[model samples]
Target: MSINYPKSIENLIKQFSSLPSVGRKTAERYVFHLLKQKPEQIKLFAKYLHDLPNNFKTCSKCLSLSEENPCSICSDKNRNDKIICIISNFQDLLAIESTKKYNGKYFILGGLINPIENIGPDKLNIKLLVKEINSKLKTLPEIEIILALSPTMEGETTSLYLQKILKNPKIKLSKLAQGLSTGMSLEYVDENTLANALKFRGIIK
Candidate 1:
């Protein structure tokens, strides 16, 4: 589709269109909306976009993006270190936290196992996760892992792979119960449903 706007507006629209779920029409609307804003407002928006990458660092333990190295959750002394909730990404971690039903540490897997996309265990943070867990075992007497992944096919595959590799008599593994519907993403689920799922998590055999 050809844009009638001049080069500057067209370039801005193109950049906006490059974002996820944003088409040319949507990008045009976004650009027009910004055009109506005051110069200071637009500058503030540009500043945020420019500083986003430098504002946050990945937590060494959970791999969550934060301003600090360990992140507030991983460094929290009040949290239950014996329980670790494994999630697919930072969004899932935030979803679970919104429920306020869990007080455990977390490990972000980075991504799920999807053969079609050529993403596998090697592409994810599984190795770091395993190493982190085993290393923590020295301090914590026993550990319980809560697999809080989505109920999608890729999520299931990743969970199974984790179950196999993390198999240990000392470590107990469990997954969120059917409180969450199949094929649903945790980030979009309501707090009540997520809370129920965490409350009724089942052991994975």
Candidate 2:
């Protein structure tokens, strides 16, 4: 199981393999592909890697990965500030946005509650969500927060906790409709199904 490549190539392969779902063989292939690229192209690729963390920062407003602090969606005047869709992560937020059925703001919880995995409420951005909502309410008359979570047990647990913490007559809470079915991840759901779920979301009352 000896790797005969140069130290530089070996290090690059190891780094690539560290990425999610990438095996050592695939990482080697990627490194070889980069070797075939023009010198300028390789420099450009390296520059992009160097700049990724500097440019793509976690949005302060919605906790999403974006170039801007508030992110384009959070700062967009056309987006409805009165409605905020709380999703498990940035991918789920993208999935919902792809449907074009929702034009509301979003709050990206870093993850859902899963006690078995040691991921609790404190691990996610729940407190920041409450603070953001209260701050927004200062300007807006009222706001509706939708729990756009997955149908898994963890998602349910997170949604219930959000409901409990956000319980109030002035603030409204809701969840995606039954059409989403049970045990489906929002990130992998089809556009039509997700769109319908948003269209017919149910109030938490």
Candidate 3:
């Protein structure tokens, strides 16, 4: 049975509940935790959330959200411009970056193709990726494109779709190696596993 929370508490609970993996009980706990915080703490939290829209800009080249247009990674000259690791989101990109093993460029696809969610190739950043690769090939003779997406069904579907669309003599496509647990998202994988996967990425046909 649901307790009759006050209107303000109920509204906050609903907002928290809408977040991924947050159920009603989890949301309720979150709200109560916030309520226990000092007023200044709550105000700081609200300020951060409110200022999020003004805080960052999406990198034009990779679509990663950062304080600058072309994120620090994209701006770094030391990174391998001939290689691009394609990921579903910023979280996964950070996961890969944390490994410190990869020295290549990155492209955030925004989302994977989940037919159940009505997401398809068109909904992702495929067009931009193709355009970027085509443009990069002009300056560079060859480019390596790594499909570093999650291991879930949607991830596989998106990878397969990408395999078909990103065809070019100069583009060599690869993906995370077989050791990753099936259906595991990259964000949750340990740094060692992620680093190994990048080190042993497999060629895609």
Candidate 4:
């Protein structure tokens, strides 16, 4: 346990350790691996990381990470605007998109409701979602809002909170079929399974 490494390398390890799921050993390995890389390559990587936070912004409509305001999906004319899929994060959005069975727009919640983490509905872009729904009702064929969130506790909490707020007679709200299970995340589900589940989404009670 000798602290003999250079200050810069130690600092890199600390930075990597701050990332999710990266332990001290993994961080050290990553720093050493980067040391083997060319100086220009490392500089480019560092520059990208440094610029990332300021360079990207969340999409106004879907809450997806993008440099543009609305993101490509929200602006795409070919996408079905009528059915908006509600997901916990961008990963779920990508999961559903991989199925190629859904053509609707999406609303990324950014994260789920976790009381322990103090992440509530207000912290999410729920107000913007409501505005989007209301505004689209007049101009689009928008009829349904599909709850494609995971079956985890936080996901269920988030979905119920949304349902309570968006309980309008004019708009139909539905949840994905029971095949997703109570604790499974959409990210791990197969494309065919996700497609089938979406095809048979049930009306939320």
Instruction: Tell me how many clashing residue pairs each candidate has.
Output: 0, 0, 0, 0
The residue pairs found clashing in candidate 4 are none
TM-score to true structure, per model: 0.93, 0.86, 0.95, 0.89
- True-vs-predicted CA distance for residue 160, candidate 3, Å: 0.5
Global lDDT of each model? 0.93, 0.92, 0.93, 0.89
lDDT (Cα, 0-100) at 158 in candidate 2: 93
Question: What tens digits encode model 4's per-residue C-alpha lDDT throughout 1-205?
Answer: 7667798888889999999899999999999899899999999999999998999999988988888988989999998888999998888998999999999999987788999999988898788889989998888653799999898999889889989999887689999988777798889988988999999999985
lDDT of 1: 0.93
Per-residue lDDT tens digits of candidate 3, residues 7-54?
A: 999999999999999999999999999999999999999999999999
User: Predictions ranked by TM-score, top down?
Assistant: 3, 1, 4, 2
Identify the leading candidate in terms of TM-score: 3
Tens digits of per-residue lDDT, candidate 1, 1-205, equal 8658899999999999999899999999999999999999999999999999999999999999999989999999999999999999999998999999999999999989999999989999988998999998888778999999999999999999999999988799999998678999889999999999999999885
TM-score of 2: 0.86
Error of 2 at 131 (Å): 0.6
* Cα lDDT of model 2 by residue, 2-38, tens digit: 7588999999999999998999999999999999999
Lowest summed lDDT window (length 10), candidate 4: 134-143
